[model samples]
Target: MTRHAELVVPGGRYVLRRARIPGCFLHAPSAFGPADADGSFLVDLLIDNGLVADISAAGASMPADGPAIDLAGRQVWSTLLDVHTHLDKGQVIPRAVPDGTLEGGARATIADRQFWTEEDIAARMRFGLQCAYVHGVSMIRTHLDSHEHLAPRSFQVFRAMRDEWAGRIDLQAVGLAPLAVFRTDWGNRLADLVLQSGGVLGGVTDALGVYEGAGDAEMDRLLDAFLMAAAERGLDVDLHVDQTEALDPFALPRIAAAVLRTKFKGRVLCGHCVSLALQPDDVARETIARSVDAGLDFVTLPTPMIYLQDRKPGRTPRWRGVTLAQELLDAGLKVAIGGDNCRDAWFPFGDHDMVDTLHQSVRIFHLDQPFSRALAMAGPMASDIAGAGRHGRIAVGAPADMILLSARTLNEAMCRPQADRIVLRRGKRVMDPLPDYAELDALAGMPA
Candidate 1:
């Protein structure tokens, strides 16, 4: 397959004939149906230059000008998007592993910050991008810890990499500070820095980041200040909200109310919101409704949230720590999933792979009841929320960045880790190898 794909590399057109794609991701109104039980059907994808030129029914003509790679009824998915991550904190394993608690994670990370030189950040960030690309992720939005002193250096490294990796991986960053930072003058400086760097304005409203806990009224005021700060800058807002099990600090509702009252015209996306699920059914429903009215978007980090939530030293976890994804998705709101933390203080087990993230989420959230819709949570849904253009679909005009799996059905694909899957960036197979862990020894506090 590699040699065949390589033969057509230079200014060529080819037909990936008879490939299976989900009907939900196909663009043509013409319909490919008689879909398989997994909701995918066979289609002929015409790849020209670097775009999916056209998609036709199975019997469509294969252009004589180019070679044909018969997919043999294998499944193909759009190259994934991971809308939430902490690339700046990636790959700090032994030195910073969390003790299976939220505050422990925070303390470990805050302690780890003392050693974060620009060289260290760039190394980890670069390694993370390599893992993401080899795993077929073409776009990522990472949260940079922006607490005054760290903001300049972190964004400096990020700006350099965002340019360096262009045309291979689309990169975006958000400034993540605690919500209280907004009330202080330093928060204004951070927001200004985010604007200058072409990054998003972000903060954590969860119990972990806030200083002395406050009641609903104080929170409403703080939330309003944060929303207005972003509004004043004309920047999009991405927040970590309600990530704790404690129901007292529910910023999901306050964020929605603040957006409405302040008329924050920019896009507002709230991640986590785990406490929403623990709220009374009426309260949760009302919050969801208000969030929808305020046009709030959501990105659920199932893997890391599972690890951080419901943890006890001796007892087994009784509840799955996740957002109300099903209810929120059903309500016409844009709900996406993310790889929140990878090999860092927050969670220790990830390779920057969204396919595995989606697969794990299916088992945890039962997202596979309608397979295509669930798949979109990591693909098109995440891309749409991140404003990464149309790269996440199998439509004619979409970029031909795709992952071709050997398996033909969902069960076959999900049953194992797809270490051998082929990644295509702009119609050609990407041949870059994954980075090795030995490269991070110096930063991870390993002995020689």
Candidate 2:
């Protein structure tokens, strides 16, 4: 047996032997066994042609032509997936000091946008991606600023990065435009840009509440237009809805209603929905039911939401800015938690590590009593929302994108985070250098 710390490359073939993994973490749900005796199993995985060719008992025969790696009973899991992030506006901390309010963060972001050249955005985005990749995230879906003036350039830069980073990390983009823009010719233009780049159509429904005198009629029109455009172009829809803590009319139900009315053919995803936590139980249950009826998916960004919602200067926060994750899960709605912003104007503190996000969410949502639920949020649940089929699970014929951690159990993995983790992308060990933002700054002709 080869006792290598990292799997070797060039050959693109290896047999991971004696790797202990949770039964629930297996790709096939039916394979999950009881948590007592069959909770953790030692298995041998055969990798061939960038896929898991076979898996068997620990002492099974190894691939004749490939080296066998001994995991020594450490835990291994499928690489994480980030369903929602703001890559176009990441890594601008300190440069854009937020005033600890959502509106203030918007102002800071707009002010900083004036200095965003293609080089600057690309460098920052590349750095964020590198951090996420190193931390075992194999797939990410980033929401880009789609203002009329900023989107074209940002999209151009993102497209170049997408092509450049292909095969290493799967990058998906969404054009996050204001809700009102969808009612004008600009909406058509935004749709065209999104179709051109093969990105999802995204709008911020929470901003609709800020529109003076904008009632349900106006909101419905804007959402209908947005969904119609996406349906026409065969694109999916992802919206930032009801991010505020106010009990104002929840847009989640409205969004679901609009999807039903528009007869949309693509998948619909709603992020935030923080207001759901504040709603009365009856109202929240009704809204969740409507959302499930419409086939809508949900992603909760706990970090940024907690940082932005109910935040009044000089006052302690009363509520955690997270969605009703447990309620959604119990209602059988697909819910995933994501690391939304990383060192950006919105939140200003993250390393794009989903494990860290998982840790925080497990506490905030009280998901530790049954650790499997929390684990799914960072792994399988997020992957389901990402729609990047077959990448976030471990099974025969599945893509071998996974992380090897230095923990013996789920509780140990969460309580004691490790830095010496190994990442594999498609059966090959990834050894890319972490991004140096200072060098990127120099390359962009900015001050260190």
Candidate 3:
């Protein structure tokens, strides 16, 4: 009693019966539907990772016992993707620090962040990596925080992890430092070290507000130096451009012009452009358009953006706290969704689950209009923006990374996210259920 059997055809018609279970039978499509006379159907129609297949009647010759999952009515979608993230510096819940009125919050964030050690950071990075892989994330761009003296330790460990996981996951590591840190000569030297050590260039800048010894001019100068250094080394840019309501949207244009002037078009990325949320529609739209014109991709950190919104009323229209996602999409600019900080000094709470981030994105932007497009945002679209296309799609030539979701339908999967199995590198299943392609192929050959 096994489900192993092959389908045989007489060029006309045949019946397929359950291998072990005798009651059920495979029925051919009626004279009016889409199934062919031979009962073979397309496994994929658009060559876009759409999993489709044909069915036939179960015949007596089929295996007597076999597992069966009736796919008479089901929907399957391609895996999801998370383009921008900061896993290396994440997983440390920082405590607030003394910074005037917000001193408490700052001190708490820093203290909490300090609790994570090199081993803990590595473990957290691996966990985050696994979580993303399970959720169908084949590639990610994570900025590693290396500002304080502790950076050397974290970067060394994460660098080793990155090397170990290189073939399995496409990981891009960026170097991060606050604006004040970059003002010092040592900061400039460290920035070079990051680039030389296979790190993407750039980090967070305090262009709008200043910490105790930081100034606005220093922030701008730091950004200039960072961009200039990246250009000199032929590296790409990813900056924490704006993260609060205090900054003006004009700052993005300033960066955009500098990018154009430096000729780093299509190489710069700005995450958490939250200031655009506060700017007038016209101004925001124009700034975004110029960013596109200057080749700056935007990655919206929906989770943290929502968390940082002013709780006080009349602060600003229930600030979604996120930048204009739909607007960027409509303007034909590159837009991605990222898990900005997961238990890090900023925000300090996340699970590396990009689907959760997408759920937030879906809700904030009223993305119910066309769900597929929204899902695409969490996947290939973002991958394309971050220059990580090789691992995004599931096409034959593309990387064999994929995740099996628990849901049976596209909408169900998107609405109710679940991770059943995760495969990385080349069809190597890291999580449970494992690779069943042999079983699937054997079943596909069953006689009907």
lDDT by residue (129-180, candidate 2, tens digit) is 8899988888899999898989999999999999988877788899998888
Expressed as tens digits, the lDDT of each residue in 299-374 for candidate 1 is 9999999998999989888889999999999999999989999999889889999999988999888887887777
Pairs that collide in candidate 2 are: none
**Cα-lDDT of candidate 1:** 0.86
In model 1, the clashing pairs are none
Best by TM-score: 1
- Which residue runs of candidate 3 sit more than 4 Å off their true CA positions? 1-78, 92-105, 113-116, 207-220, 247-250, 312-317, 406-409, 419-425, 432-448
lDDT of 3 by residue, 104-203 (tens): 3445545645545666567667767766665556677777766667667767876788787776567777777665565577566766777667777667
The ten-residue window of minimal lDDT in model 2 covers 29-38
lDDT value, residue 322 of candidate 3: 82
For residue 228, what is the lDDT in candidate 3? Answer: 70
lDDT of 1 at 133: 95
- Candidate number with greatest lDDT: 1
- Stretches off by above 4 angstroms in model 1 are 1-11
Deviation in Å, model 3, residue 69 alpha carbon: 8.3
